[model samples]
Target: MSGGVVTRGRERRDQQNGQNSKTTEQKRDEEQVQLAEANSLALTMRSGLQAISKEIRDLKTEMKKDLTTLKEQVTEDVKSEINDLK
Candidate 1:
């Protein structure tokens, strides 16, 4: 009877270890999937930020040109008005 009890105990322990190993493997797989998704999201955000930065730079350049043209036109108009007064 003692030998039978020892064998049963060992079987139970082995079953428990197997269950723990399976659970650990499942958790590791889930963590890997989550890490991959996070990496993909980060890459998408980086690309979007880069595109927005380029658009802002282009807009700034265009605005500067428009402002310079307006300033030149205003200066010419003021000069013409002064000449007319003289």
Candidate 2:
């Protein structure tokens, strides 16, 4: 009877340990899933920022071209006026 009692106690302790191990594994799995999601979000935001930055650079280049053309046109008009006055 004492041997049976000891066996039963050991079995219960082993089952309790198994449950704790499973719980720890579950928490670890959840943390890993969360980390993956966070990484995905960060990548998406970085891609969006890169696209917006490219667009801004393109607009700046276009504005500079427009300014250069305008300056040339104004200089031509002034030269014409001076030649007419002479």
For each candidate, what TM-score against the reference?
A: 0.89, 0.77
Clashing pairs in 2: none
- For model 2, how does the per-residue alpha-carbon lDDT over 1-86 read when each residue is reduced to its tens digit? 99999999999999999999999999999999999999999999999999999999999999999999999999999999999999
Note the residue pairs that clash in candidate 1: none
Estimate candidate 1's RMSD in Å: 1.2
Model 2 misplaced regions, further than 4 Å: 77-86
User: Model-by-model lDDT, in order?
Assistant: 1.00, 0.99
Model 1 lDDT per residue over 5-26, tens place:
9999999999999999999999
TM-score of 2: 0.77
